[model samples]
Target: MSCSDPRGISLGPRQIADGVYWVGVNDCLKDLFESLWPIPDGVSYNAYAVVGSEGAAIIDGVDEHLTYEYVEKIREVVGDLGRVKYIVINHLEPDHHASTPRLLELAENAVVLVSTVGARILESLYRVPRERIVEVKDGERVSLGDKTLRFVYTPWLHWPETMMTYLEEGGVLFSCDAFGSYGALVRGIFDDEVDLDYYLEEAKRYFSNIVFKYSKNVLEAVDKIEKLGLEIRILAPSHGPVYRKRISEIISLYRDLSLPKPCARATVVYGSMYGRTEEVVQTIERVLERSGVSVDLVDAARTHPSYTLSLVAESAAVVFVFPTYDASVFPPVREVINYLHVKQAGRGRLAAVVNTFSWGPSAKEAVDALSRAGFQILEPVVSTKSLPSPEDRRKIEELAERLSSELRKFGSCA
Candidate 1:
């Protein structure tokens, strides 16, 4: 759906079983990409409605603007908005909790369910009443009629209070952001019904932008869930469309991302003051490409950090090219390097540093930062002043040779 559609409400009511439904609220926030840290294509806010014999329960709520539409859809399906007995806040993220206050007011007797950490965040952030909150521990189950809702605490899957809710009878897991992506599924909400390639790209972008930093915690949380041995018939995440089939594939994808899998490729990202460092990056790209190694040339000034992190996560090596200014690497390149270090993105990868300066120790300093970040240095760093002479080119060739050798070793392992 176009962004400007005033009635841009895309909702889904997929029946899980008798008297149960998976309600998907699509693209609840308008212009979600504009607000993302490094920007995204778009995103959806998925909320589920579970109908039972006694009453109904809404798993999560969309943003303020979409709450009324969400309430209306529930009323349409269940015949009454007042019958919603529980509002389970799987995550207190704004996209999921912004409309919660209004929903609680409408649901009257419906209790707001969340983890203790989630409750604290909601009270501090949204001023949600403490008495209305129902704190659930990990593996805690709450019965809503014939179906039981089980809460699994998954902290730092991007946020501390994040958790997943599973419908015991339905075998549907409402994963807040664990297997989520950007972009709403306009026509359908299941993986089998949509274009897998497009969704996978969005998923990668989402993980790269929002979840890559907390990858360690993600792995731990995934392991915890696996130990529970719940029969997962569908994977419903808050941001992206649901996975009604191939649930194992999505779980495997997340598991793989949590592990280290490096390719025999190098990404040379550089920021240049003038043409000097740019020349070096171009030379390195050509040198690597000629040796039958894949290379990605990213101008740090133009490429976003999210895409760069993705490439770093996939590559066997990363070459940082910088122009020295006042005994420091260029700001953009420096920022990227620092982020990579902080996120530990260069794990199990070879790295090399190159710098262009009039006369300074900036190249050595930049190389030191990469070394401290746990990158295995493949060669002595290359530095140039004014322009590279034949000797400088020869040094670059040697550095390229060292890098190629490292990649060859990595290839043999693969």
Candidate 2:
């Protein structure tokens, strides 16, 4: 699908379901998402417009930078701005609601709808009169003539005030940032129209980087939906393509990602100030490969933590190889460990350490960090002096054998 539109919009407003139009914007200009994770495929800020028999509502808003085009897309769907009576904010993250100020200016008659927490936080972010803000509770229903909007509280799906809007008549769930992905929707608007393979990986990466920390909350939110028995026909997230044909597939994928199960693969996350530590890593990789163990080798100096977090979170075992520096852990390796903790990637996982030092052997720092991150440290915390000697190489091979044996026991989740 071509990603160009004559009006400079990446995609024109497209219909996802009856009376529900996608007013999302593809942001190819930004190199990163949240000024952190890289977005080589770009990202999308998805918004939606739901037209009812009596009144119209816009679900979420695009980034502030895309305000003009966003409002224009709404105009394309709603025709008259005055017809918009509600601006439902599922999540108030700037990426989703930054353009709301300008959008409210255009739709002067529209009232802002938010959850209880959203009401408190939205006031801090935007200037809206008390009468204009309607705070809804979980399971609360708002009437839009023929269509009814149900609010489901799904906090920490990245933020405290996050929630989802369910359209009763259309069986559409407007989940902002919950079932989201990173890549821009350049191909098409719906899941059936786009390439599923590419978007799924982007979604996994998005989950690993952004939502993995609140994975328990994500599972809770999913359970809430299940217990309530909400039949979601269309999953309209704040980013990526809308899921219509494969709603169940994305929902299942999200559930699996949220629950950290042991996969057979191992992720080798390492940092090397010099060539010494990398040489040890090479030996370990070769042994693991020859033993028929699948491995993902990530150089902490070169790879971003977001990508590594994705691999480590799913892998059953994670091996850290870094040289001790200044009588402490290597800085880059420490950064990766910090991110692993924040992402909760080490929870219920096995970890091993290979420390190389020219002066002092400082395996304490690596062990403490990994233990704090909830990794079950394996035996033989191999420490070497600068580079591996013949004896050190034997120890390394022993460590590899242990890892290979343990990895074989843990089955793959792929």
Task: TM-score each candidate.
Answer: 0.89, 0.94
Q: Estimate, for each residue in 358-402, the C-alpha lDDT of model 2 and write its tens digit.
A: 879888899998899998998888899985789988998899889
Error of 2 at 389 (Å): 3.6
Report the C-alpha displacement of residue 243, candidate 2, in angstroms: 0.9
Per-model root-mean-square deviation over C-alphas? 3.0, 2.3
Scanning candidate 2 in windows of ten residues, the lowest lDDT window is 1-10
lDDT of 1 by residue, 1-414 (tens): 333345444455666555666565665346435363443335677888888887888988777667777777677677767788899988887778788888788778788988888877777768667788889998898887787889999898877988999899888899988888777666566787666667776677677667777888889888888889888888888877688777887778777777756556888989986787888888888888887788888888898776787777767789988888777888888988887887654465688988888877487777788888888877778887758889988998899888977786656223
**Backbone steric clashes in candidate 2, count:** 1
Maximum-lDDT candidate? 2
The true-versus-predicted C-alpha distance at residue 42 of model 2, in Å, is: 1.2
> Pairs clashing in candidate 1?
none
